[model samples]
Target: MTRMRIEGLLAAFPKLIGTGKQHTYVETENVRYVYQPMEALYLLLITNKQSNILEDLDTLRILSKLVPEYSYYFEESICKCAFDLILISLGHKENVTVAQVKQYCEMESHEEKLHRQMREDKIREAKDEMKRKANEIDKNKAIHVIYRL
Candidate 1:
């Protein structure tokens, strides 16, 4: 029975992870994307990119309380798509704890930092553009904003 179940999981793994257009276990809104562990992490990272004040290690402990299964499983399955099962199970859960919020914030911040440095690059870009416009008004020439050395 256990062997059959594991075999079933392997057979249905792709569809369960949303890899196929017509999955047996789930039919996503797009029905085109694959759902995997990294994808979950990526989503978590993307949604909380603006939170910079999160303390992830501590937050993980906090999240463990509200979602011990999720918290523990996430770390364990950080590299697999099996977390999708957890995602489905936890989908309707209400009222995530502050730690869960902080955990997501940390996830996003780490992801964003990997792509951008100096943190507030977007804000600096807008400021630099305004400065360039002011400079152009005075001299009628293009001004360059070199953010890096």
Candidate 2:
């Protein structure tokens, strides 16, 4: 639901601001949105309206730099993976350097990729188990019906 709303807001921006105007941030009553445009997509960050704009800009810059380091493609899945790396690099720091971000991204990306793979494997195993159980139950039901006849 939140993702849908963010995407909707992102889509609405160009129309609201006019096509030629470039906006780095948008502030509402309750929230502030900072976005960086890539080749095929926009990366958005949402923050409290009261937060410092300068800090937000710094964070946004750091995040945008990490994009090219992760993948050359701007597809949603690649973006998601890149976002994970960005989040990991940011950690609890208010400021970070390019080298720190790059190093952290490299160290964490491998672990995150492995974690994602394990999670997907578990989901797949669960699905296979459910299918097997379902088939077994169906077979038993058919056998009972035959015995009844």
lDDT of 1 at 142: 30
Q: What's the lDDT for candidate 1?
A: 0.43
State each candidate's clash count.
0, 0
Give the CA lDDT, 0 to 100, for residue 69 in model 1.
43
Off by over 4 Å in 2: 1-17, 75-93, 108-149
Tens digit of lDDT per residue, candidate 1, span 13-112? 4544534344212333322222223324422211122222233223333433434345556545655534421222242334456665546545755667
The number of the candidate with the highest TM-score is 2
Clashing pairs in 1: none
Clashing pairs in 2: none
TM-score for candidate 2: 0.54
Q: Estimate each model's TM-score.
A: 0.22, 0.54
Highest-scoring model, lDDT: 2
